[model samples]
Each structure stands twice: as structure tokens, then as C-alpha cells.
Target: MLATMPAAPSDINVLILDDNQFDRVRIRRMFESLEFGFHLSEVENLDGLDQNLDNKDFDIVLIDYNLPQGDGLEALERIQKHERNCNATTVMIAGDDQSQIAVRALKSGCQDYIAKGTLSTHRLRSLVLSVIDAAQASPTNTDDLHERLELLVSRVKEHHSSALQPKVAMIIQDIRSLRARVYQPHSPLAVELAAVEKRCLNLWSSLSETDAITLKAPKDVRVS
Candidate 1:
């Protein structure tokens, strides 16, 4: 059975990178046959892919592992370098049934991988929907989990006053615990965990704003 697409507005944007014109068209046709709506931009080279990615963001990016420059994995690496493209679902297309390629791609940050030779509309739909669903559920998918969290922690230290270091440390703890329960969302524990994380974020924001106000305040000047 074909997977049902989520309740999304009009056609979702998609970017496909393949040096082969035939493969690009084949993939586009598969998407066309699906019940789900999609607006696709096809690129035949890394330069084209970079150009499209630079100008706009896509809902998903499909990468073919064979290219004149490097490969699909290389393309994925380049995409990872751009923070705006971080949320876009990325999938690797392999020419043959190579499990190794799929394993490596997944570890390196792709949402999923598929063998192009055996690609069908059903498989494509299912794979695409599954990754999209997972991404929607896991906010951690914004970027590498540890990397994103570290960036936030650094910001907290920068704008926040030194006196609140203890509270900041506690918030950091809550964030770590939040990470553990992040994927296992659903229970009351998860609900509370999310709340705790929200509070932590708000605390940081409020602290930064307070500090800014203090710095901008004028001191009372008395005539000596």
C-alpha cells in the first residue's frame, strides 16, 4: 500500500541531483504518478545543485551517488554545510544494490537511501513519507543533535550574566535529559520533558533581554 502524505499545503518543493538526464526524468515521472503533490527542480551537476540550494530552500533533496565531481555523499556533505538546507530531507540514490553505500549515507546524515535500479513509485513514496514523518516528530533533526545543542549552550553563555551560571548549568542538565527522551515522545514524561526544555529556552531569552536593558539604562547623575 502507498503511504499517505501528510496534510500539507499545495505542492511541496523538491530538488533532485543527478548527472544523468534519463535518471532525473525517470525520478520525476515516478513523483508525477504519485497522489501526493510535488514541485521538483532537477539539477544535472554539483554546480547546478549548489546554485539551486544557494538561491532557495527545498522540502526535500534527492541525490544520486554517481557524479563527475565526487558523488552523492559529497553532495550531501556540501548540503550539510548550509544551515538553511539542514531541515530538507536528503536521500541517496545508488545505481546498484549496495548495502554498504546505504549504511554510510545514513551515518553521514542523509535521512534515507534507495537503490535506483529497483526504484518504484510505491517504494519512493513510502521512503519519502517515512523520513518526512520522522523529521516532523524529531526537532533534533534540525541538525546533528550534539552540534546544535552545543551552539545553543554557547549562546546562553554569551548573552547571559555570569551570576546565572548555576541556573544555566541546571538548564543544561535538563537539556541533556531532554535529549534522552526526545525521540521517545508520547508519554507524560515526554510532555514534561518538552515543557522543561521550553522553560530553559525562555529563561535564556529573558535573561539576555534583562542584561541588555541593564546595560542600556542610564545611571542617576547627582551634582557633586
Candidate 2:
């Protein structure tokens, strides 16, 4: 009997960074043939990668180990630093037989490494699925905090829209007062805001840790 296969989920966005046209074409074809879903975009080099990243959000990044200016490792480091909530698992692809490079990539936060010559459609599908699973399993607290802040801002805007003339005048006055107070270096309100921001970040970190632990427990139980 044929082995059962898992159902394909909705298409996840993927960014492929490779300078070689042949490799990019081949990788795209392989992904197209897979049962796994993917909305793919290709970049020829680091510049292209940067532009694509600025405009789009990808679920996974497949970076070539060798590039024109700098290698994949450098690109990975830059991406991690610049992209907020960049939890996308990076996979380093190489044609060379350099085990050390693979190890280094893994150390630098790559989810997996695949030799270019050995890449197959099935293996690619499996790797993508694993990365997506890991991302879903690990939720970042910074993202949650940013989301809450956005919601608060939206509510404030809504209140501003529905306010009467007197309320609007009062709100405008309050804003001007707050701005003036913030300009003073020794202002108590500024100190208070700083403390609140720090506390919120700490709370976010604590919540992230707690959520990670909660997620891992169930996985551990299933594995055991």
C-alpha cells in the first residue's frame, strides 16, 4: 500500500535568494511540483533580497551560500537585525562540501541547511513544513506587544472621531501640554513614560517565556 500523505495547507510565501538563474529556475520548478503550498518569489542577489524583503513578508527564506558581494551567512545576520518579528527560518543552500559552513549557518539561526546538488522536491517540501511548524509553535512577544499598541492607537483615533467640539478642544490642549512637558529633560512625565515602556517590555518577555514553556510541554508529552 502507498504511504499516506498529509493534506497540504494554504500557500505560504517563500523568498528564494540565489544569483544563479539556473538554480533559481530549478528550485522554483521543484517547489511547483510539490504537494505543499507555496507562493514563491526569487531574488538574484543581496540587493534584490533587500528590496523584496522591504516590500513583502515571506514565510521562509532559501538563501544561496555563495553570492557576489557577501555570502548567505552575512545576509542572514543583516536580516535578523533589521526585520522585526523575522521568525522565518532561513535555509542555507550550497553546492560545496563545506560542513563547517553548514554548522555556522545553523549557529547563526538557520533552521536547516541543504546541499544544492542533493536537493529534491520531497525534501524541500518537508523542510518548508518543518520551518512553518516551528514558527507557529514559537510566538514572539514583541509582535504581541506591537499589536496591542496598534489596537490602542486605533481606539484613540476612534474616540477622536466621535468627540464633541468641547471634547476635541480639551484633547488638543492635552496633547499640546504633553508635548511641551516631554520637551523638558527633567520632566516627571517623561520619566514615567520611560519606566512604563521598560515595564511593558519586561512583561512581554515574561509572557513570551511562559507561552514557550506551555507550548513545549505539550510537544514533550506527545514525544514521550
Total backbone clashes of candidate 2, pairs 3 or more residues apart or in separate chains: 0
lDDT values of the candidates?
Answer: 0.75, 0.70
**Per-residue C-alpha lDDT of model 1 across residues 109-224, encoded as one tens digit per residue:** 99888887678898778766765676566755546877889778667666665557456546657565666866766777777776776666566555555433243211221111
TM, every model? 0.57, 0.57
Give per-residue CA lDDT, model 2, range 1-224, as digits (tens). Answer: 22333554446788999989999999999887775567899988888888887887777889998999899998898678656426666889987687888999999898789987789887787876676566556645888978988788666544543333233334434544554568775688766655554554443333333322222212211111
RMSD of each: 15.3, 16.9
* Candidate 2: residue 39 lDDT (0-100): 89
Clash pairs detected, candidate 1 = none
Off by over 4 Å in 2: 1-9, 135-224
lDDT of 2 at 167: 38
Clashing pairs in 2: none
Worst 10-residue lDDT window, candidate 1: 215-224
Task: Give the number of the best model, judged by lDDT.
Answer: 1
